[model samples]
Target: MLHQEKISVRQFTILVFMYTLGTSVIYLPSLVASYGKENGWISVLGSSLIGFGVVFILNKIAQLDEKKHLFELLEFIFGKWIGRIISVLILMFVIYLLATNLRQIGDFITTQVMVQTPIYVIMIIFILVSLFAVKLGLEVIGRTSEIFFPYALFSLILLIVLVAPQADFSNIQPLFRENIAGAFLAVFPASEVPYFQLFVFLAIFPSVNKPDKAKKGFYIGVALGSFILFIITFMALMVLGPDFTARNQYPTYILGKKISIAEFIERIEILVAIAWFFSIFFKLTINFYALSLGVSYLLKLKSVQTLTTPIAFFVVILGIILFPNIIYFMDFSQFYWPFFAITFGLFIPLLMLLIGMIKKRKQGNGSQTPS
Candidate 1:
């Protein structure tokens, strides 16, 4: 296999930024408010710090052998059988992530946009478009993002600007005086959603054209994305109040609906919704890329093109059954997912770094091949 699909570090950075904002932009304000109350923005800061550490850890893992895919590197660090076991475990998480993101798009469209469309129909259409993006290959996905990513940012900035005037400083009053533990507790939950899932990039790290710059890009993207998330959360609390923001499933969307500039700019939420669609689409595309490639590696397949369809079908099925209801989904994301995320996000990466560093020392330590 030639393994020739390469993406620029710039594009890699863009993907990271967009992926970080994906669904978090739509749902994070409420999640944070439920936990952190008035200090949700502070929680975003704590999460961003943790995000920096995550990037550093994953960057070290990639440097273990920038030429090898994540599965190959795992096998080198843990040997054949254990590595395969770990790979399967990681892919299971990947499937859950893919299914959840797909389910989100499905639910959002049906409930918020169309109001009458079947969820399955929405999931199917979304998966098909994402399937095409993934099958076209990573480079194509990267380039397509280059073309459309700006509008997402522009809309996002406009969202922030328009929503800023309505903010009430008293809504976020007391300045971290109440329920401070809740604010600290909110850190992991905020970080877990986007920061933890970044390991998906390991599957495609070997495809980066410039490893050094791509590493920087990862950090920059996380910083920027977390800042964006913080601003959104702050505005949501200031504009909607903590109680209202906490109860709403999609505070960011509601913020959009409230963007009435002199009463003339009414209901441009659909325009803002376009930005959400793009962000989530790119996130799904990158994640499905990892899922397809990981499965291909697990199955020892030479090509993943044909595998994409069946895998997408499986995702749709899991998306349907994964959550009995959105309430269950939100509960899982809030109360339980932080613990689940750390196993792969922190534990596995740290384990690999420890073992790989030990192995490198034993082999004279100049980035030589293990075994």
Candidate 2:
């Protein structure tokens, strides 16, 4: 039997916001700064505009079949053979994402928070938490996200307010010096890795009880999350300077470190770390959940929960070996991740939508012309 669980619009909106904040807040400032320099925030804006377009496309695809989830719609839109091929490929990408997120959190903890702890231990603990969430199903994940949203939002607001003292608007000088091309070039990486990757949400959107509200919620969530990123990117440029921001692996963390209010309130970078952990945890859970669902759908299994353990194990193993080092990982994210994201996130979905539309039009004409 298909899972009958559903989440409210509010829950879905919270999930979308939390999911967007998950990895982008941790990595985007540095990456965008590196490409757009002093005007890096401008690049972020450009990327966000593209992100909105991607969301529009995704929303239309979701509306194409209110009753079918993304995986089911695949076979409906295409045909059995082609749809299965696409479904398998998407499943592989989803698993790869789970592994990447697992590795990312592990790397962040081992490098920034606890230099002495083993990375595998960190990965296992994170995986277990995500596994629990995935097993609980989408409604539970939605509720968990709703519960944590306020804390995460507060932490983010506090980080911004507290760090305001260190900001130097002069650091963002000569804003348009990079010209449109420079900013446009930065958009591919900045937006694709973070915002466009939201295509993954397609697999989960059908879980929403109010499908009509999904489009509105998605735009609101993406807009809000991108605005937060905009603020962080601008702040990083102003406080850390573009050159320094570009060079750092995690500029938001560095921004948190710069917080000092009369020397009495210091070392509150932990707040940023905490918020990042909360967001990333949800992100990992959602992706893992999607992966389990895909596996069950592909293998014709009855329950997604059964596949969770083996999938978690495989993810942990992949996370352990996926990246040889931090440099190579960051390099891949910069040069390679956008293309990978676009291929699955944008290209495949758009193609499916196009084909579905053509098929629908033909069927309508055929019925109208019946003898």
Candidate 3:
């Protein structure tokens, strides 16, 4: 595939940061707190460390063939038949990811702010908006991330400061009450969903204008995004306490509701929620972009843009079916999603790397033949 448009290193970094923050801000804090309790911060740190490792793996794989997108690299390294199978699995995962995110945000809005609105209505509208963004091309998505960067930052900082007065260090007293095993279990979900899912970025990595700087962009983006997540999880524990944090489906939203001033300032939860909404929009757009791109590549289509609408419509329909209710969504997210993530996010990439190395070695030996 031709690299027709390119995003600068800065833009790429911004996209990474936003994408990492996307689903994490709302969902992860509660999930981690539920498992690790007062030790949730440890789980957050553990997840971040694992996330960094995943980023390193992805960046190295991208380096293996700096010129080719991930799908092409798979085909190049694994041959046509196997590569097509891997590509199909990855494509399916991205679409499922897109659907879950759409379902998540839809659930959030209907349950919290839009009590009168239908859930499907919310999901469809959000899907349409994100689909339009994906249709504009990756360059546009990159630039859009730059514009949203400051807003996300400001809202995050503002929320932390606003909620600081409610902090109780005592809530986290007697650390490791559940011991290391519980925190370790929590770490898997925390890391897997937001961080490891970055595997999809391999599809987008070749679009970086400065291919050499791509590694730097990936590191900076993941570091910054994960740090923010750590802070949010810490704050949720400190302010809400682990019990309250875990009980509420959207702990961060409740955290938002707690942002009260002496008398006048209040009810800015919606404003804070917008930050998550914007971040998830970028996440959905990029994932949808990757899905469309993968499909076009597999089918030998001339342009990925051609399939955007049809794929997006399918995503909306699939989103409706994936989660019948919030209970099932949360159950899948907690119990099943991490393993599913590992299959595509961890195992597949590692297999590709191992196979890629073998292929390179064979080619090297062939070139040294006496004939």
Query: How would you order the candidates by lDDT, starting with the best?
Result: 1, 3, 2
Candidate 2 similarity to native, TM-score: 0.97
In the range 254-287, model 3's lDDT, one tens digit per residue, is: 9999989995799899867989988999899889
Score candidate 2 by lDDT: 0.87
Instruction: Please give the range of 10 consecutive residues that has the lowest summed lDDT in model 1.
Output: 362-371
Off by over 4 Å in 1: 365-371
- Candidates 1 and 3 compared by lDDT, better number: 1
Q: For model 1, how does the per-residue alpha-carbon lDDT over 54-144 read when each residue is reduced to its tens digit?
A: 9999999999889988888899999999999999999999889999999998888988999998899999998999999988899999999
> TM-score of the candidate numbered 3?
0.97
Per-model TM-score, in order, reads 0.97, 0.97, 0.97
Number of clashes in model 3?
Answer: 0
In candidate 2, where is summed lDDT lowest over 10 consecutive residues?
Answer: 175-184
Measured by lDDT, the strongest candidate is 1
